[model samples]
Target: MPLPGTKSRDAALIAEFRMISGASEKIASSFIKKYKSTEAALDAWYNDPASANGGTSTPNKGQEKKLGEIWEKYKDSSDPKLVKIDGTLAICEELGVDPGSDSVLFCLAADLDSKVTGEWEKEPFVKGLASYPGNIDSLTSLKNYLPALRKKLNTDPTYFKKVYMHTFTLAKGQDFGARTLQLDTALDLWTLFIPPALTSSPSALQRTSDQTPPQFAEEEFDLWIEFMRKKGKAVSKDTWSLLIDFIRSIDKDFKEYDDEGSWPSTIDDFVDFVRTRRSSK
Candidate 1:
């Protein structure tokens, strides 16, 4: 029989949520009581590592390899949604909680990190929801590197990339008519599903991916002199600055490994960086 009292990892969650939210003991206990069912299942899963996919506490070397393993195991899962959401929940559960707010927040971070390349490579952005184009859904969903995108970018670059490209194609300088495309409806159809996610009532920003590091790396961030020539398609000046800022943000993480530099995580961040920087100039 499983251990009594509580599962191993999820036991830690009570503390995590408390720390992040600064919940009072009374509030925390009350919240725990309110969400007892979710907490219990989460803890139980943590107690049994198998409840989380892989059934092992160790991580496979790289994100790419890890993703390959997940695909092999679950591509044929009897329950699809279970594998997708619950699988992710396993991580949050391990982390102490899985708030929908957190999921939506991270997705946004990923887009900003990867420069928002493409949410899906088809119309309507949402993978499976959108008509697949070029036989590829999104970089985030690509077969080989799913885990890598999640690990490295803290977001799914492939999936977001695919949807981003599709959104761009659809919105390429094309203005929407009054009340043409409902904001939430648009995000619902996209790979990332932003509006309903970011705001309780949706924002008007629509779809926009523009980060910078990837471009600099793509262009080798070759001294400021060459930044202009290569940056047109790869990045913009404001994006370049933001990349510089972000690099500073994680200087500690990348410093020990290599003094070179870490890149931004999304296409959206990059695009804005360039535009903002240029406009400022």
Candidate 2:
């Protein structure tokens, strides 16, 4: 009744779904049957973004299952504080997110769309977190699932801005600055978030060599100095992150400024705005 290799293919899909959802084989099979193909089914799950429907809704059943699994594991724990705090750390560790102090709490609140009930105080924020059950672990799973959405969206330049904007928002303006993000974590964000955002546009392709210069010349440090001189500012490794965020914003506003059919198509554009033929206004 099934096509050649259909059994193996179906088994593979079941395994992948189980890994992502922690669902039983029956649940995974039921989940996978809704799509014409495994890939299409995965796409539907990932493309659904966060919302306010609480447990009844999410981008996909897999995400809902992840939250359910985490809750089922820890919901009845005797130590609420331990589950609340250490459980967050466990989720962050799995997601490769920073968990210094209670940073995970803030991240969870932001990701879960919890209301900002207090004036930037953790106490009030934590108290208001009641709206989001599964709290820390739920947010972690949501963020963990976002990259799949991001990867799918990256194919369309329009969604590139969405990826970083969503990331920065979830970070709550605290994802940068001195000792804020480790080098490896920063690199991961850059790899996942930067390259897609910086992709040059079709309009930029026709530009001449003189119009677009490299961001780095013989010496990388010298190029950095040139960049500072143009902006009349200096940056340490920590501060450089702020600049990166600024660039992300610029990309969001302009939607591929590189596509403007002009210069400044490369990182070198930031080196000297004046020489890059960009309007200094």
Candidate 3:
């Protein structure tokens, strides 16, 4: 307490910790002292179930009010209660994310329960922020929450699948009645959603002993794209949704692929296409 400059330094650290973890000053100070840094304190706070129950589980009334304020700050100029593309870009900037980043945008959309790509209504926007693990009232808290969200996309297949499927809905833009995704748009999305590897096989793609099972072999993905381009047809909803099942069910060599199965016609045709190409090679 007697240290002159150390008081300000401690206060700054405590403030940063409070912002990130929504901890009170006393709690923040205790964590900071125990962990010796703001980052470490946050790590401890996130891992501690007792602390998390109080601060991180769900936003309290004050945090909900703060979320409303943040929403108003970024609301669309035209709509006042909506967040459009311009507002979304501004929010992305505040969160330290590139507005052009597809993966981050996908994660954000899933987290915020965004119904479409360029627009967010007030109900879902504030509600989703409130549902987030920790209090995210300010840019600092939002920025701090993003890494964990992105990591969930990378590490949890089930969570990634949920987000990936929602991406199709988002990609439809404002068209609720749309049943097909355009060929170019579908291909671009496949490239973004399907994790890529440099090699053609799963074994070769493994960089570590504990790597998760490969989702799409690069060669197989290329063949699918080639077949789609050659067909020159819009991707039907069935085809798009069934592609995930197809990828998970088939062997890399297509030995397990069954044309007689209940797969969409496009998938059946793509299997034939793969076989024809393989025979020619």
CA RMSD of all predictions:
17.0, 10.7, 8.2
Q: Order candidates by lDDT, high to low.
A: 3, 2, 1
Against the hidden reference, what TM-scores do the models get?
0.21, 0.40, 0.73
lDDT of 1 by residue, 87-181 (tens): 44443353343344333223322332322222211112222211111122223333222222222222223343443333433332234332233
Local accuracy by lDDT, each model = 0.33, 0.41, 0.72
Task: Indicate the TM-score of model 2.
Answer: 0.40
Q: Which segments of candidate 1 are over 4 A away from where they belong?
A: 4-8, 11-154, 175-281
Show model 2 residue runs off by greater than 4 Å: 48-110, 114-163, 169-192, 195-281
Per-structure clash totals for the candidates: 57, 1, 0
Clashing pairs in 3: none
Best by the lDDT measure: 3
Candidate 1 has a TM-score of 0.21
Residues 187-249, candidate 2: write the lDDT tens digits.
344444444423432111112233232232224333334454555432234343334433433
Scored against the true structure, residue 250 in model 2 reaches a CA lDDT of 35
